[model samples]
Target chain A: MTQYTAVHGEKVSLLRVLGPGHVWALGVGIVLVGEYMGWNFAVGKGGALAALIACWAAGMLYTCVAMIDSEVTSTVAAAGGQYAQAKHIVGPLMAFNVGLFLVFAYTMLEAANAITLGYLVQTVGGMAGFADTHDKPFIVLTIMFLAFLNYRGVYATLTFNLVITAIAFVAILILFAAVSPWTDNVLKPHELLNGLPYGWLGVLAAMHFGMWYYLGIEGTTQAAEEVRSPARALPLGTMTGIITLLIAATMTWYICSGLMPWEYLGQAVTPLFDAARLTGSTPLMVLLFVGTIFSTLASANGCINDASRAWFSMGRDRYLPQVFGAVHPKYRTPFRSIVFLVPVALVFAYFAPLDQVITFSILSGLLEYTFMAFNVLMFRKMWPLGTIKRGYVHPFHPLPAFVLLALCATTYFAVFLGYGTQLVAMMVFYIIASVWFAGHRYKFVKRGAQFTMPWPRPVGH
Target chain B: MENLNNFQLLEYAAWGISALLGLWMLTDMIRTNRAHSEETLLSSKEGEIEDSLVIDPPHQGGHL
Candidate 1:
């Protein structure tokens, strides 16, 4: 049996595993892709401000879920993430389903990021030649690069994320400064009121796009086990990163709007680049293009690194194939999971359109978040106040938990109602998972496989 | 519309109430630890600590 050591022979403290700047970078990386790619399609200039508010609200809700999860798992910080946490709170049958969706969420997100990276490479001036005949090849190269970095382990991945995020930030600041002259153009009173006719329902519907910008707030929680001091670092990193992303996203939206007309932005394929052109500086445009490329790559890398861990954890628990669970002895990482994920991402990147992939990715992620939010509520009821140790708690108790549960479920159902194709696809995927889990259960029972229940028995006999 | 805004305000007030509830939960966790330690002392005196710590019945495998 291989023994797992907490420190892994390193004298690093939890704070040492991450600094505030690193946390900010991770948070910014999470939001930038959505802002750059999905924001226009999700919401227009009038709806952007509302979307920002929605993102903050969603961030708070996700933060609450993470708090409950950290306390429940004894702060073990496993890669299995919510799948591992769900298995402990709910039963394996439910967790198996959650695990399947979790894998789908991360893999789909990887595909989305890779496809976006390909487009960015093609559109950016210097790299246009690379784009002409080599779209799929570019995606494949990106997948390979991300997979290798992730396979190296968490420290290298976070360091790379920090550097990429810093570059992206500086690029955004330059773009903002260049566009500052057009600040008046960006803050149109009419644009802010454009969606007013739709009333609250329209605003809420438009929030679907806003929520996309906030999608990855829960990502760092998945890597809680890899962080040095999960108990303290997890909450601090998560909250700070979320706040930073929220501010950056809001500012980016404002800057872009200020630099161009709402009509142009609404139709823009690459709005930020267009905003850069307003500055009339070739050097700055080049920097922005490079930043966009780095942003997509960093986001893809983070998704793959976190997703592989979740898959490996499921495999270790026998919910997935045994091969996925095998850690590379030398690398101390899940080499197989990383290997499997990259190809799947590349296939989707090559075959699917960017918009379709984004929709599917967001839909799958929404389902997983709904399940997780529900699990938090369930854990609160089952474990109650006294069962756990001192860990961060959500500001509002059952109320915030209850409100998030309601809003998340409502949004999920609303999306299902609107997007019939995605609903059908999600149903088919769940049905397949159900059949696989049933088959696995039969085989295990026949072979007398040992079962480990999620919860520990009451303290004293 | 104004009434609805008031309702939103009320909802915010409710959130404030819940924040207090969260603080109460932290206090409860502290109280539970003290009680657990006392229980452990009594159980140890009665030679029940080891028995309680051990997993009963050989572990069995199946969907958990």
Candidate 2:
């Protein structure tokens, strides 16, 4: 407690203003958009039951992620998430690549959310008899609005996220209740269930899309610097967040699959909105309409927050540029990094088609997940158990790491099966970026200063 | 421009506002860079320090 107070007396930085609830909001908010739209692409690959299997399988993968992250982040206690982990446990090049993965993955997700918001607005305009409305302005405005929330401060941004995320989660429950699968209601799972139209291979293929269900829950660690008690808050918020998303994901699949045919549900742009429409209830449709809009906004807002933190940490260590490391004096936010990534996200949002935007985001996320498994193994082997105090330590030893690696490999293969060209292209982009960073950026980083966390020396050396 | 409908005009308004906000953020960032020294703004020593709540593991050896 004395040490905590001592550290706060003299630094200009991100405010220690977040709690467990903010952590939950940040994690869940980024992911709840999948419940509204993106996860149905799994249904496209497999049938309904296969998609459900993919959902739980993907859920198992993220569960391992949340566990491994809790242990490392609780001890590492830095803002860069896996980037910081790599810096300490892995090497400079891997840390640099992990940084790029976090930045691109979240930035692309932000773009996807912005794109979805634009389309949803145009959809509303179409229904209101404005036939020729453009989506570009709406896209730009959505990004700008969330950017303002993030720029102003962390507390307001996440609190707003909490409200919108709760509304979106509840809209799914409301749709579930209105349909009332318990009684004889609108859901017809018996009639609508298609038995693995693409067969077992389809279930394997669907695993990648199943990831959309709880994609960014591990992002809770990015707020490590902001949390008042990271050990308690990080695990509490993250564990609860995973539970919320699993329930929301299962309910979303059940309702959408029961309400609409698996064939149509696979391709629907706004599946939750479409599910409400299928029930012939105007009120439910209105609720879902607003729910979809809010979820996208919340997601984009959370992405900006996480992406900027990863970039800012790298910049602070001179991994990018010192300019982006500057924190705003009054707001105590990473103002420069937040502003720098705006146009990058904006370009991708404004130009890329939404599905392509989402595919890019998922592939990037899968790559980041691959890094986590190796990271924990290195940390445990180098530091060993009880070498340094941990805020929270994950149980089950190396089992989680092994499980995470196997799942990540399977998902990578699944992604390759569906998107071989895009997968290769994204890998090429990262390799090119890596070469540039090693030649240009890595030269400037202060190697010793980067090791700021006060821990005993590693076991070997 | 005159051929545009009410909805189209509103669409342009949204774009204009987005541009304004974007410009505002950039200028604010630039202003911030000038108002503070690089070290002052970048000094985030606390960010690297483990919060006291995360105690070191029971020791065969103590933490740094």
Candidate 3:
């Protein structure tokens, strides 16, 4: 007979699963690429002061949502993540919607990253004489590479990320220091605020752009269960990750604005790479290229892994399909979900342009964030914990949560209104998810099946 | 330098720190993983429970 521990076994410790360093690396990896791509544009349009404030606001808002997730859910495994959490709190249908949105958004992100990676390779390949290749072949190769690495499992993926993140971090610092002499000439107040559409509406629109940099704050929570001491580590690790990224992003923005002319910076195709070139170091340019490529790959890998886990969790719960729930018996990874995600990403990659893919991804993410913020408030009210844990809490409580919800909702509508095609796409996504849920429910009823949370049973009962 | 401004200094510092921190994080990952095997072995013997059970059953309308 096979031996099994009681369901209510000992709880895992954080130190064992995710060391402080790995957690930090994971946080840095998520923010670096997005900021590298868009920070200059955001700061130049909003002004340093405005950008800084927005970064803080958005970061804190994201952090609150993550903490609520950690507190409300018992375990922080990568597989179930937000979809599972939402399912537990609300009903299956809402949970299914969250899963659907997340899968769609993340798949779009994979496509975007692949395209961007192609562009990056083309840019750098110019130096190495490979010549520029367009979308299809590059996208296919990139997807295959990421899939292979992810399939190798989390350790390999994370290890690769750590190395790449380190190199990129060094390149960024060197570029910043080398260009330090040009700061005064580049830092113009009007440059910061110019090129913006106009007024408060423009600023609000700009905030939507800023939200891109803060995209993965809640992602760390998805890995909660994978980390050892989830109850303690999930909250602390996530908050620590967020705060660190906020500071890093803010500083990077300020430096980029100070070191390069905002007008020129906004128009540049490879802003960070260009910044490195301006530093008068050819080696720095190469470093920047490598760093950027690494950051993009790392971010793509993390997104695919986390997203696949969310889908798998939903699938296990019967909100999706049972196939997603099937863990690789030996690897102990969600192989089926990963398999499902890769082809969907490939299809999107083949058809969608990178910019459109990114915009759609952001729009979907905002809707999820709106629901997440609302979930936080609902969780706080419905399930009050007398003792607040060591993790950071929003100072304003319901107000901050409420404000974030309203802002996220407003941002979603604004984006939807501004982009007609994306709005239509969003509608189609919702409809598809609804139809899927109805079908799932019907099947469940036909089989006389009931849904239940995946939990540890009490020891020896 | 009259040409250089606060914005530039902040940017330099930010990038500088990111590089340093990134490098540190990498080193830490490698170092910790080396030590981790033994620690994991010890902990596995402790027979700790999974975190999933902490949730009040899903029927109670709690996040699992």
lDDT, each prediction: 0.59, 0.86, 0.59
DockQ of each: 0.01, 0.25, 0.02
Q: Is candidate 1 or candidate 3 better by DockQ?
A: 3
Candidate 1 ranges beyond 4 A from true positions: A1-28, A44-76, A125-132, A181-201, A441-461, B1-64
True contacts kept of each: 0.00, 0.45, 0.00
**What clash count goes with each model?**
8, 2, 16
- Kindly report the interface RMSD of candidate 2, rounded to 1 decimal: 9.4
Query: What's the CA RMSD of model 2 in angstroms?
Result: 5.7
Query: How close is every model to the real structure, measured as TM-score?
Result: 0.76, 0.93, 0.76
Please give the distance, in angstroms, between residue A252's alpha carbon in candidate 3 and its true position after superposition. Answer: 2.2
Model 2 segments more than 4 A misplaced: A1-10, B1-4, B46-64
Worst 10 residues of 2 chain A by lDDT: A1-10
Clashing pairs for predicted structure model 2, backbone only: A389-B56, A389-B57
Q: Give the Å shift of residue A110 in candidate 2.
A: 0.6
Candidate 3 lDDT, tens digit per residue, A37-154?
Answer: 8655555455545555556666666666655655554342334567756665555677777777677667787777778877765554455454333435555667766766665356
In candidate 2, what are the lDDT values of residues A46-158, reduced to their tens digit? 98898899999999999999988988998877888889889989989999999998998899999999888888888778878887888889999988978877897788888
Q: Considering every candidate listed, which one attains the maximal TM-score?
A: 2
